[model samples]
Target: MTYSGSNYRGAASVPPAGGSGGARVAAAAGGGPTRRGLIGSAIGLVASVAAAGGGFSVWSTANDANSDLDRAFDLGDLEDRPEDTPALNVLILGSDHREGNAEEDARSDTAMIMHVNEGGTEAYAISIPRDLYVPIPEDPDAAYYPDYTGTNAKFNAAYAWGGVNTTVKTVEALTGVRIDHIVEIDFNGLIEVVDALGGIDIDVEVPEGQDTVTSIHEPYREFSEGVNHLNGEEALDYVRQRKQYADGDFARMRHQQDLIKAIMDSALTAGVLTDRGKLTAFIESTSDAIKVDTDFNVVGTAIELMGLRSDDIVFMTTPNLGTGDQGGESVVIYADDPENPEASNPEAVSLWEALREDTMAEWVEDNPEAAGQDEGE
Candidate 1:
């Protein structure tokens, strides 16, 4: 899926998927159009946070089809998240393994930080290229994980070397932002979630000769694009089709962001909140496919997320101005500036810094209204 700036407008108009399924809570206070009203909204937001506190209980009590034992790790005592922290940074990892694959563990095809501002009015998501070189920490002795001597390697390799903790540590070291939570979704689980919400509508800007690329799966084949509706399998291929594009993974990140926005729009429009059975089933199908720290649970997460509207989400790539080979492997280097050295790259470091400072209000003041919602509400 390819979206120009205009496409962002259309995406904002799409309502959120709503159903009685999954965990549901009251609408957050201060969510309506008043600056002081946001305080009430913040209180309601805490309720949602409280609900998320019990997310695991909801997952455990819900359906368990295709569940994996490895996906069930607890968050321990990592709480103490400051209520005033301007942004909540969540590390979302997409593993590239499907059912019946010989490989027990799959490489992460995608890694991103979903930054939600303190006010919850604006969100910024930035993707980390899997190939970018980064330092990996030593592995735990009891876990039998690979130990790295702090040598630079592909970003994704950190996960294979140590697991989620190592990946979080590596990213924290790179960005200087503390990750409040982590979520992993596998290929099968992603397809199932998309299917459950119904297919997402995506606008594909078909470049000339786009039809030459063949499809990966048998039933869902690739086709010429220009506003196409995609099912789960087809959407998976849509975002994962880096080989066919000249821009490689950079293009893939754009498509991935588009797919995510599409899913959020469709899911909200479908009223997933009101449909309890469907929500429960959808959660069950995806539960085993994901791994989150113990502190994160469905109830609290639902509450925290409930405060957000589709317009609240923002997506961009890391700023890259140069490319070169490190250790005989290709890598993309983030320029100190992409738009202008004096001006920060909206894609990478600056956006993160804005989130870290909880200054999205200021950022939004600088950026044109993209979400189309009332500002400061």
Candidate 2:
């Protein structure tokens, strides 16, 4: 369970190229597909060739997208993460924003903590509710805008108030873990990525209802449920719709995780990693919407992460059951207590601890049914 940073092959001893102090870890560990001299030599060669001719270009263009996205928001000063850390925690923020999306800019609809073990073989993602009440950090140096008020506010508002830095800091304070990277993707990018992959297949447990706008200004549409294959827009609607579900944002988070699993499964089956054109397009189209820490480069990081199989990844929500009043606002509390565990039980914490220690296979062994499904591409 003790992860040695030295075991990772691609992490730069010094700083990575083209970034502040962020280190790029090569993807050779059990995390993704980082086998160097070819386990499947023929396929590797073909993939390499395809990648060089098209995949690499697509990746470069995708980097351009990141550059374009940077113009719209303030990417905080890069944090210098020490190399010896046991796990790399990344805050994955999914925004509802689209082109000229003024209304959606007010909040972050989805948030998840992606914890990748230092060795890179395993990953555990824990989704956090957007409506959770937390204190917004104050920015003393801002000349144009005064510091934020209120002791506690909805978590998503952190992004609207001070952008990524504030959100990251807030989450770090909440989780007691330092985030090594932050990746934010918007609705347009999500749709494009799904489309680039030829649409993702997802299983809808509850039947989907149509969204009929009461007024012309509101968006309206309908969706049929029951394990239907969803295209880009439908998939977006599937994850974004919450009013129909009883749990609202909580249900939406579960649906989002389900969609991600489906996407991963489909991507694996479609051989997206080997398909140079599709892979490049996927990266390029999504690049603009994705904002990562200076240390995280998609291509370089993915290349290092190639060792990870779909089955190796595990996803869960933060253990929470009841609601409470914080600062006169309703909020979900994560893990009320260790002894009398409610939603955030010791089991959930232990699950995360197991993930940080790279002992997730043990956890999966106990839950064979959940582990049995085919991890789509």
Candidate 3:
């Protein structure tokens, strides 16, 4: 079963005004909605099932979501990949566009790689820090920028320079891994998705000794140390906070992971999947929040990975040597050498090898620290 390539129609479809690279960045920035959303589309695509006798609604919902994604984002030119590969690597880029933040200032706030192994029973979510210093790939789409690849810049800059296409190239160049698909997540639909499911429970764990973490946004909601029910707005505020944590963005990433897992759990336990009204609302909100590459078969991949669950997925971060000051700007000192394809951070190279070879389970066991959690006693 093969799917035809999609015909995308978005801000990326039209060339930037005046053929200016800056204009391209500005155009891409304004694409996302005002309020930040969640990674709902990623789950919505696969959460549907063709039920017996009354499966038409589910089937129809999935089809609508698929069509929405098909017309979503333009991935530019990427390497053609066969659908039957032993493993799959999907690059998920989360872009945020807040009010008062100029369109030209937009950048990918979150970047994660979802690697599904050969068996499709388990998966890995590898988050790359946006500040990780890496070599920017020359944008064939917008070649106006001089020396685009000469100086190393923050990882998220790839999206600002040329949207998804440049980001894909940069990741491929850095990890030595081929990207099977691309997903651009808009942070504007989280509220609706969470609201549709009633609300989600997130266990807020403050850093070691800290008692509680307060939201930086308005109203300053305080999250105590334990399971707290979060509505759409509260969920948005909770995950958007990073400054309160000692590790900053790293802490926020973990929270985001927690939110995603919680949403899934809430849907399952709260009967969102079984209740047609809730399910419809969930799917519709999710589908509206994301765009994907043309060839990405959301339903097909979901069907192939039917039995997958939250516990089966592990979230990890790319190896880095913490934050550092580079050229007067703070950046994440990536453990790998981005300029050279053959040379990379030893541990990161091993991680990439495991991903490429479909041996991440063994790799995770051996490198527990990089697995995003400490080994239990």
Best by TM-score: 3
Q: What RMSD, rounded to one decimal, does every model reach?
A: 10.9, 8.6, 9.6
TM values, all candidates: 0.69, 0.68, 0.82
- Among these predicted structures, which one has the highest lDDT? 3
Residue 360 of model 1, lDDT score: 53
lDDT of 2 by residue, 142-162 (tens): 222226623456777777666
Predicted structure 2: lDDT: 0.51
Encode model 1's per-residue lDDT on 175-247: one tens digit a residue.
6577766666666656776677667687764435664345555654655676678777777776766666777
* Deviation of model 2 at 140, angstroms: 2.9
Candidate 2: where are CA atoms >4 Å away? 1-84, 101-104, 141-146, 207-219, 271-276, 326-328, 335-377
Ranking by TM-score: 3, 1, 2
Global lDDT scores for all candidate models = 0.51, 0.51, 0.63
- From the highest lDDT down, the ranking of the candidates is 3, 2, 1
The local lDDT score (0 to 100) that residue 300 gets in candidate 3 is 49
Worst lDDT run of 10 residues, candidate 2, spans 32-41
Model 1 TM-score (2 dp): 0.69
Residue 242 lDDT, candidate 2, scale 0-100: 65
